[model samples]
Target chain A: MSAADDEIAPLPSGLEEARSAFVALCGGVGGAKLASGLQHHLQDRLSLIVNVGDDFDHLGLRICPDIDTVLYTLSSLNDQFRGWGRARETWNFMHALGQFGGDTWFQLGDLDLALHVVRTHRLGSGETLSAITADIAASLSIPARIIPATDDRLRTKVVTPGQTLDFQRYFVEQQCRPRVEALRFEGADRATVSTGAESSFADDTLAGIVICPSNPYLSVDPILAIPRLRQLLRDRSVPAVAVSPIIGGKAIKGPTTKIMQELGVACTAASIAKHYEGLVDGLIIDEADAEEAEGTSLPTLVTKTLMVDPRSRNELASRTLEFIQRLGGARRIGPQ
Target chain B: MSAADDEIAPLPSGLEEARSAFVALCGGVGGAKLASGLQHHLQDRLSLIVNVGDDFDHLGLRICPDIDTVLYTLSSLNDQFRGWGRARETWNFMHALGQFGGDTWFQLGDLDLALHVVRTHRLGSGETLSAITADIAASLSIPARIIPATDDRLRTKVVTPGQTLDFQRYFVEQQCRPRVEALRFEGADRATVSTGAESSFADDTLAGIVICPSNPYLSVDPILAIPRLRQLLRDRSVPAVAVSPIIGGKAIKGPTTKIMQELGVACTAASIAKHYEGLVDGLIIDEADAEEAEGTSLPTLVTKTLMVDPRSRNELASRTLEFIQRLGGARRIGPQ
Candidate 1:
């Protein structure tokens, strides 16, 4: 109803039998919520293309925050109250690290340190991040496929007022205090799109692709910055939709709106739609931003997109899938 | 009473005030026990030259078992029951690592892992092992210095039936299951002795050096393997003595007896004394091996060398210092 376009097509019938598999593009926390929700409804049929842009080495341990968040979310091991890291986590490692004068701003939990140690060891032994992630997911008994955007180095560097900082340093260490001048995805130009991620789009029974409610520039854009991934999404034939991270001129979490404002862009769902302009067939906005959605020409789904709990997450995921099926079954919807 | 040499020189005047500093060559556990005893009496006057032969990277963690044991023992944080790692330790990290199918054979406690993480990170940042160890020791407020034998990769390799296994693999992972074979310190010929370790011997107030009751072939010899260290000990004017690791024709701990037997050497204090024939001026024997002292040409001290308690350790340490003083201050004791 928020869409300005009057010629919007209705959803196709038989969604249960026709659609069997789909991919979800996700960041940590917020996106992981939707990804977890999708996994809840789609079960093993879901593939999460997790952002590895925030990956960095801390104290010689390879930390992939976004991938871990998604994995923890899907496996139901993530702390719902804390909104990060493993549930029932201990801080003995962090306490000890602090005693040794080590940098403690990142806050690596004791239980979570095991994954990093294993990952750093395996990566040092020449195992691909994709392979290790897949193996870890399987070990956790997570049926859904969790894939990184790339096994290669494609770090997201945030250029602030005076200096550029690594994604984790900017976000976790500095607490995003620095005013962002710009964002750059290092190594993204030459980095290869993960095979699993690319093939997810080529699946014959692919229902659609859902860009989870993650920061457009910070999380999702880095994955899209890879030329191969960018080109594939541009030329793909499947219906793709994005759930807006911004709600009521403010981000639900993190510095999404602050970054958006710093970048000289309006912090609104209309801007989010414009940010994904040609890539997505539809945009899902929160009920709070329904009135502002009329400014965009893209088809829109107005609902309570702030996925506060499992029920809300599932409801949002179901609605997004229904919207994707409505545009066209396993086919891209042309721009109005 | 144990020494046959009646010409053994008496202590120099101002013995307590003049002789303020000394060094102790130590390995883990038993050596640390004696080192702790020495520390109890000497306070800040002791410097522990710990063996680095057992140090190895497990799961990318630069694990220095001997140095850690000495540090933990001295700091009173060592788990007396387990004879390793920090007290009040948790195994959440190890359990998680096991869940991920990682190498969990080498136990890394949650609290202990912080040390490895910090060490590995600093090492990766190009900080020398000695500098890091010093920093860690300072942070822990340990009065006595705990110096590794070398900063270089001087690993102890065990030559088994047809293959060479790294020290930790031969010891911890394999639990010393491999049949006795020759032991070699890889990189020993090229490795430079740690500066602090070398300087500890050169102290002007250097009362003497005590070779703690560690394995002769497996532990003590590795420190002696470095040509420079061996030469330093040989040319030193200070009195040097070794407390026997073997008592009652058997090693008190570890695989000393097994390894000695495999090397075709008798597991006796006499064989142990012969092992350090020229390096040590005197040998301290346990009451059980008091009769074996007659077989050695060197001056000997017979006492309860099994430092089972703090009181016993303090007594043994006081006796060793008194014996060193009696050998004539600032002059090497010639062979009897």
Candidate 2:
């Protein structure tokens, strides 16, 4: 057993007869962390529906940051210290790109390019993004079912005060420098849930949904913006819990808090709860935000939610799963 | 003046008024060497119409081997010592490709990928190969018109005794081990010369056509196989001269002599002249094959053609241009 497995509670007694399958929604780095913990905790039974809002064609190759992050994280290839990409990755491609005066703003590592190349080729050959993502997961020996939110081109267009920007342009190229006004999922209205994702959530064996600590407006909201996907999630009878991305009025990573403040919302755990208020059955806030958890619209689980290490990640995942089990029982389901 | 200038006779009195413009046809490595010499010697007055038969899409990126070789060679970026690709290049991309279990037959350097990425993007955007190549040349400040023989998809498919293979699959992946039966230019029947290549050849100040020491049957032949391109060269009134790839019954680089021997042709300067019999007005052979030039079908220029260094390459290029000028005076146009 991994060090992470030691912290996770064993499958709840009656459910031990059959391993429970779960569907977790996630975005990039922050979401990948919690999704990784759940992957380690639940192993084969977990399905991670990653957001496709951040997907972009850079230098002619389709790059899916969130799905790639989940794949790299679960496969133990992610660079934790650098906060992105594969460990021990070389930046020769980027350096050489600079030599040619090609776009160097978006960093592409030599090792990272292999996945992009393969994905680009397969996509060019008419394979769907989700299929390519799953094949890559299988190639990396990642056991969990990693799914893209939708196969269609549902790009996140950040409508800042000055202009609209592609997700990568706003997040990476501009370093999230723009003031947020509103966000748009370019193709979300027409897009349906990816092939197996909706069914995975609707399955009889589905225990619950864990909306990981990804940015609500930028990350998780794009996936939910797909009308059918949102309707399907809303229609599901099982308990859906969200681990608050905000803790003590700050996001763990990325532009979540900044974007929230720009959108004129209070950058606190309570606002995060309110953001996903109608979708989730309960909210899991960090111990730092336990005081802010008062008078919440939904049932709350306050725990040590900062997943700094493998042990902490597992502990938080175990506590959240345990909380889900308790909520699946007597707690009245409120918002759909 | 360069050391090669010592052997190069001054431009004749009448021709000294205006520096002449020349159109040279070439392929990879060996061709690049001589093309570089002419580019240095002629500066802006040279047009290098590179063979496009070797172009292929690998890892979803359009790679024009001969055109890239020309670009890298003229820009002083080509890896002369290692044979192909850019200098001071890193193979981290290939290593990572190996890690992903990607195709490892054809080697792609990290620096090289930048060009491929940019080209692939441009090509996907509906721009022709010639346009992309010229644009890249401009980006690198390559002065000569680095034109592809044709922008159309005219691939060189090697027909070995066993089976037909793509140019790269035959040359790189298989290491040219397959015994040649015949080679096929897949789209030669319908392909036309690139937009500006024909006009460059037919210009008023056009001096001559120099066929560099690239493999005649493989590299140069594919360009000639393009019906319009061959007809255009045939229709040209100016002297068309060739430097024999063979010197002392051996090719300087690649499988020229081997393919010649396999194709049931004698590997001699005389045989090279015979191959280009109807097309070229003169043949330039090395000192080693001076005896083989005796009673050859075409006018022959015997010189020190072993271009082992910069001076020697320049010397050969200067000598060939002088031979073209000399041939332009005394020779009667025989083949059309």
Candidate 3:
């Protein structure tokens, strides 16, 4: 194995204690980055249960922004400069759309459009998004398994001060300008947790569940909103840890901090912990906020949460696995 | 005015000619070339009615290939190399799609996708294809008015030796390799011709009709298949001429000749002339196929039919106008 692969090797000490799978819940951008980091460490043992709340119909195409972001990021094809979409993307299609007087508010690059096209075609043919996404990720040779939180439609509707708008309209077209009042997953009442995700949780060999650092209300909530998903997570007799999206009262990316304030929540790690309170057994917060971690009820691990480089990601991932091992009551079987 | 424009000006000399409008029925590629030629000469005076038979649900986006081709070609945005879609296009979206195991067979370039996305969105929101097309054309500043044959669903299904497939499947996915036994326009029986086209036909100020050298069955037939459209043409007191797609007993492009033979029709100018016997008042054949014109019952005119360059397109178009004048017809006055 290469030096990079050697560094990415599963913790021998933790593995000897108990071999367990890791399921990460994620959204777009911020979540995707952390998911990529986790995938780097866990490799084939990672199961990504991505949120579909941001999925919306645009120009007759069922566009799953979060799913696509995670998929592209995991495959290392994500446009890091843009922080979303595939690397080396082009906007020629969007330019023509402008010429045609079509809506160009939400820019879809050429490479990015292919995913929407294929997914839309499959969905139109009655194939579930979960199945199609699996095929797409598999085709890309992504070692980690990416699955939708649910097959049923669960649109994230942001109820702002004046009106409720579709997620994209709020996030993309409107540029998240509206003051958030409440957020709701429209189809969550009817949504069942994807069978694959449920199976992962039920599997006896399941190791750990890591909630990737995504927007709590906008990303993670939608996945948890699926009627039985929270119950399943609560019932799972395995270590579940959440990586805090906020550090020092600010979101690492997106409008998470702003939205938190607008919704009358303090933009702090405490707020994040309060949100995922009942679901997680442990919380991974940045070392910068370690001084404030003592007050939290959950078992806390202070680590460098920011994934600025590959080393940082691997270091955080290793610490997270080690913390899970200690919390699971597994005996450490190797040298530190 | 230019010398050629002066000679072909609307209302030439003293002649009690029948009032007719120059209408061209078209599909994509080959049809768009002729349509572009006619538009260049006739300007707003030409009504280019495009076939909607090939429009299909691709990746949940409503893709109207013929209408888009005509629109793109007239606007000078068509990619010459691909013979369809926009010029200066990028395949970033398509390449990304391949990575995701998408149905890359029907390549939707990034720039090309914008049109589909916008059209599909507008269509889903209850906008008619005619209105959307008009908006698109006007945005592109196209001089000629391009209209879809119908606002209702009308798909061309090609019945190959093994099975019947949609037009895109036969033309794109199957690479037109399927030996066509028959072709049917699904939903054509209930489809109504677009109001814009119907109004153009009903207008008493029409000059003369010119059928572009597109495939008679695949392109023109679908337009004629609309209920009351053929009858409307038959009852019109105007000269209607058809420019034969066949040149020296073969199609200039596409499957016209092959489909003709499969359907047990002779793949010749005589056969094309016979197919439009009652509807067309005259027939235009290439100079190379002048020998075959003797057997046709309609008044025949010979000219170089190939439009490889702008000069060739204009020359053919000019000859077609002159033929209409000789047959005792005059161009209409006013903007169209």
Candidate 4:
């Protein structure tokens, strides 16, 4: 761990629930923030099953946006102000790339590009995405095990009215301005869960799952789209709780709310719960949405779901673990 | 063209010989500097036949070091202080790569890496090296046509007593410490000369060839090792002259002198002339090696060959062209 990570104050230190391994299904920025919170509390006991649906081949390099964000965020190397990529990054590579008429829309920071190059080289040599991510996480001193949902090629193709755009084309290059008609996980059926996540699912010490505050359709859906991974989630006896990405009828960052609105879904905590109705035992909403708690059919935990800072993220994580223990109804070892 | 290229005062402006198309067989650094001078004078009329033997696939990117050096040099983007790569280059990529436990021996500057990424991507998409190089040169606004000797894979392997090391592994990683027992071009036989070079050789306006002051055995020999390119050189009626890399019994840069000693050959202008033999008509020797003029069988031009600055490079190129004109023995258009 870095000197910076050592200085984080180690939140939720007294929470014994952290000893039992928990997995968070994550997307990019918003989800990565909560994943960082879980990582801090659980340390090595946490596993982040990051979405690979947004991963794409650009400039012959394998670029996994969500995985990289989680790696950077947990390692405390992320740009907090920008809410993405490594801090103190340079644009010299992009500037030079523009001089050669290369695609500049993705905005790959100089420090961020090194990760892409390493991942591309390793992937080209037949190394799995999960293995590479694990090594990179270790290199960045990220205590949590960051595994891809699947090692196989599973792309999320966004179906707009006129075109079927690649995930990055819709998300990054197009700035998500295109109204989403639908979304499809291209190779989801063939994709299988990584051994790391599979073993975590098939383990005795496994605790409840926490679906982080990421977009439901874009992030969580892709993982669940994989039949093998979905089967594992379905067969688990432990409770699976989800923190709502929606706060006060809006997403904190990104086009989550915009996408939801375009897809004809209401921008409310009840709608967020409805999206994950079958998959999750309960939904954790923000204090602003506490009024809507009785509106959902499933059980609910209303808290400050907006992780404005590290402290708020830790509080939400600790509360969510307590809620999951309540939902499971048996796996509790009380405070001595 | 950049404002920097325009700021460079044009040289040999009124010389009618500069109108005639001349091709320079070049390698890296030293040759690139002279090629820059030639480009300054000849512009669109100059063609650089760059050696591709030193090109290697490093970390999944096709890195053509010599070609990049020549392009940077001719485009006035080369670092004057470092004598290689782009000026104002950043090492952020290398720094970040080290964090991932990546290979750090071959230092890839952030600005320089953009070219490799572009080239590698294009190559993966089935684009030829010559075509991509031409596109990149055009993007850099370089008027001189920079042509790779071959589009095929041709690597220079250092055959030391202990092991056969890759050119970069020997040159950069080991810092050229190992004694050079021998050297071999891995795929020279199958490689064909680029169309840009073949067309230049076939052109009626072709004046002569200026073999730049790169290492004779390692650089120029690789081009000559290709049977077709050698036959074209042998068949050319125009005078082929060489600028001797050796001066005052020492090489200006690289392992030229050490390699000569290891191969049991003397480092002298006469020895350089002997190495070329029938491949070149005359040799351009530095004034420092004026005493060795009598020792060579071929006709020699004794001049200041140390290209300390841009002006020196221009002066040497101007002198070499003048010598080639004199060696050709007939065609002259002057005092227009």
Candidate 5:
């Protein structure tokens, strides 16, 4: 599609009714896509509570992979081909860093380095990640709120067949080469849900919670691992739903299916429903996986969730909103 | 002069001289110019022992302004117009930092951020600034050794008319507008000279110490303030000579004269000589200030110290070497 054509596209009609407040638990690329789609449909009604376990300090800058991906994708600044970072990026800084024998496993572009630099500066100056993310997203003119799951430092570690590796090492550097044995969130036990997450839970206008199609073991679990987070979600009266990341026994992107298979679980929508068993009241599976959704105890809806183009994204977002409304939830779209 | 013509200029005779070891005490811009000239003239023989009192953490990156300037200048990569940082630089990172409400007075360039990133990473990994500098300089094809005077944190504070401010605050943010009352090196008394400095002092074939024409108050004093540094220079049999940063009651660059006046000094070449009276065995003054040479206690040599062009730089470097030889010092030239 031409750039100009994409810019002036009209909003989907489903978004007109998606006025209810939402808190989404998200990962990086896969999750970012869904989060972006939801923001397009619901705008300010969406609040993305991103995973901080994927955060790592590389080249002395704190990189929140999932958080930045979500922020960039929502702001329409993300590089489409790369799935992360900004479009039209330059690597002059990375080339120079390589000359100095610095860590180059995780590539950082010149424009993207500005994000890390600003975030690192704010973190050092004693600002919480939540506050910093809000300020940064606002500067980019992103209408939806983006926040970390918690303010405290939480690292996701994967126990592979050979060794325990940090999230980035396993996901980016190693490219998910090792077979998964287990997973754990290092600081989740002590991490408190950020005030934004807390307020989202307390808000009477909240319609439902949407768990984006992020990696179950590596992404969503970290948010759920926070001691009181799951209990808080359970206490809320609003409907909570999750979209299955796996379709036709394969993940749309990343290592969701790989990790699930390594862990000896059936990689399907049924498995996703079972994984989020107590947390979510509904499940959304792609139409391709409709036959596999019959056995799930929770109410399930089928839609085309591929999101290959803007039309598909808007369509899936509209379908999801309609499903939420069928569950007795009313959307509260924000001011134009 | 055309850039091409500047490159075809003849090398000085002293450029072929080999020496076992050479040491220089340097500051920011003014000192960096002489150090660059020395590096050009002496190449591998030069060892720069830079003062770290001006070093500070800005935006979480350790910024050693003098050391970076000297390194960039010696590598022929310095931004001549800016007087510091790398040439052909971009301000994207600094602009982003300003957008995030960060302290933006320092003007860190995009390419310059790479150095800070690498240095900060290495330092955090337990590498000393000396080792990191060596790595960076070596990568840039710079043959000289660059060492920080001390590894411990030492800060230069200017006691202005009203309050004492950090070196960057006084020099950069406030544009050096504050009247100086006194200047002090905060951690100098407790800082031990780095191993690089001590080894240069103990080298059997050590030549004369060159005090580059950096500001005496802000640039060179911190190096001298380190415990036993002055005594080591005084006890050495080799001639320790200083080049005057001021001529005709004005500094060649920076606030050397203003600072001297604020402290009630005459701001003359003789005053510069007297400032380093016991530390220096000889003083090199500009031909314009030849009238004041007879009044100084130390043996003085008058030469063209202005390094407006490569020829002037080479001439001053050759004359300084000739003066060292005529002072009856040991002949320490040629390949080690």
Candidate 6:
């Protein structure tokens, strides 16, 4: 059990009564899937600290893609077919924008444009991203607390062999084709963690922390790059675990594996576990990567991690929570 | 015939070659209708100086309603049924905006939003509204030069019995329900006419100027409120005529007659003509207001000024041009 639980009373035996609340750190899409599952499993007890490194200003609108994904996913408005944006989304905005000779590389769907417009207005009016996100999530009737890692500016830049490009320029405009040499989170060095996120992390009732299956180099690291935020995660008093974004030496979506390969890192669950070395107590891997777990010294849980449907998402969430409970009860153990 | 035509060569006997180029100052909707007719009739010879007083920063978007109307109407993309915005527009943005608890009072259509997005971005990047408007009109393949009255800020404000309100607040939000007492064009005193509009006005090839059938106080006055703009119109060498916004003691649309009555003026074509006594060389009135014309001192053109369709719009435009040509040849004349 967590140190706080041990101090309070005997640890609850059942999964549902393990702890009162937890925090989940994640990026867009893949992370949103697990965030959705976590919300279903924990309801209002889950607080999502979404990566804002992917946030960018386009056409004067501040677009927070990761926050929107988590919001759409948790609110059940996410398009399962396209795996992004709201369901029944229209592309007429981008279509018309194209007619006006606007940049259509990063498509802004009609319904999706609304969020960006409102968010931009709010941000321009002195509302912090954290407050705006909370307001939006609440308006969407999402029970979970969706918080940005920080409210201050912290944009990700992908450093390629030839030049440095903004996250979206590299990801969307160039289709992630550039050979990545390194990555930088501008403004993160002096940035402070969002008040809501800081409070949520320090909450005495926090059960565990889940570093969702998001890209470590791009998504997760930006949040980690913030000094205080990284410090909090590194010195967590509860059992913290991570779900591997990589499975069978390839990502389920996006360019995670390619980035890892470009960084000259081994494409294995053990390698991912090593990357998270001291921060996470254990790593959850797909059954496809179960063989690779033998080489890791950290505790690991092997399961069907490809959450293609709601059922799979729920099942994986349950398995992840149960694993956290086991690790909480018996400190960090050797690899299974 | 226009004096410029006499200088170059004998004026052609037909409506097509009566004058080379003319300037049209207008607002939204009603003004746009006649502007459309003028564009079809004059082709590249028509330069529209649309009123920017109605322009406002709404939710971080620089919305120029009159400019958009002129653009959409000229391109035949205007929604004839709805009387505003682009044809076949979608409300997915507003729908999602409402879901996000954003202000849905000002409805932004999916297709119409493209202009605002691009305009806002360009404005943020220090591009003048005039330059951006020209670029947009050119991209839309509109032959006529569409220009804002001035690039500097000039917002309309309405004074009610209770308090003052911004133009959009009085016009759109209040539905023009407030009892108007006075009106002001904020920042107009310091505003300068846009370069293209100024050049078009001073062009030696100028035929005449058509002050469109838009609300005199709300639309036309804002353009006139600018000191230099008004001075230029007053001292113009060519015929300058205005089509009466009021017909049969009532405005064809909006609150022109209501505002007139509220401001202690008679709701008649005579009152409208008198309003521009020292400004316009002549006035065009609907045949229904023939009696009201007898009271005006300026040269008056009696015609079916109610342009309910394209046929009527084009017919009125042809008649207006013919009248301007006659006045251009003979100079200002007594009422007939």
Candidate 2 vs candidate 6: the lDDT winner is 6
Compute the lDDT of residue B61 as modeled in candidate 2: 88
Residue B35 in candidate 3 has what lDDT? 81
lDDT of 3: 0.82
Best by lDDT: 6
Over A1-336, each residue of candidate 4 has an lDDT whose tens digit, in order, gives 444444444444334644687878999988998888787678888888999999999999889999999999998899999988999999999999999999888888889999999999999999999889999988988888998999989999999989999999998888998999999999999887889889878767787899999999899899999998888877777889989998888888888888898999999988988887777888999898889999987799988888767777776777887788787764344321
State residue A34's C-alpha deviation in candidate 1, in Å: 0.7
lDDT of 3 by residue, B179-235 (tens): 988889999999988898998887776767778888899888998898778877787
Off by over 4 Å in 1: A1-13, A329-336, B1-13, B329-336
What TM-score do all the candidates reach, one by one? 0.93, 0.94, 0.90, 0.95, 0.90, 0.94
Residues B65-175, model 1: lDDT tens digits: 998998888888888888899999998999889888988889999999999999998999999999999899888888888888888888999999978999889899888
Better of 5 and 6 by TM-score: 6
Q: Model 1's DockQ?
A: 0.70
CAPRI grade, predicted model 1: medium
Each prediction's whole-model lDDT (CA): 0.86, 0.86, 0.82, 0.87, 0.82, 0.88
Off by over 4 Å in 3: A1-12, A330-336, B1-20, B261-267, B329-336
For residues A263-300, what per-residue lDDT tens digits would candidate 2 score against the true structure?
89998877877888668889999888889778688889
Candidate 5 regions off by >4 Å? A1-19, A293-295, A309-311, A329-336, B1-20, B247-249, B329-336
Rank list by DockQ: 4, 6, 1, 3, 2, 5
Could you arrange the candidates by TM-score from highest to lowest?
A: 4, 6, 2, 1, 5, 3
The DockQ figures for the candidates are 0.70, 0.60, 0.69, 0.84, 0.52, 0.83
| Collision pairs in model 1 | A11-A326
How far off is residue A59 in model 1, in Å? 1.0
- The candidate that wins on DockQ is 4
Model 5 alpha-carbon miss at residue A290, Å:
3.6
Give lDDT tens digits, candidate 4, residues B46-86. Answer: 98999999999999999998999998988889998887899
Please provide, for model 5 over A167-264, each residue's C-alpha lDDT reduced to its tens digit, 9 standing for 90 to 100: 89998899999988999899999999999988878877787788888888888999999977888887767778898887777998888878889899
What is the Cα-based TM-score of model 2?
0.94
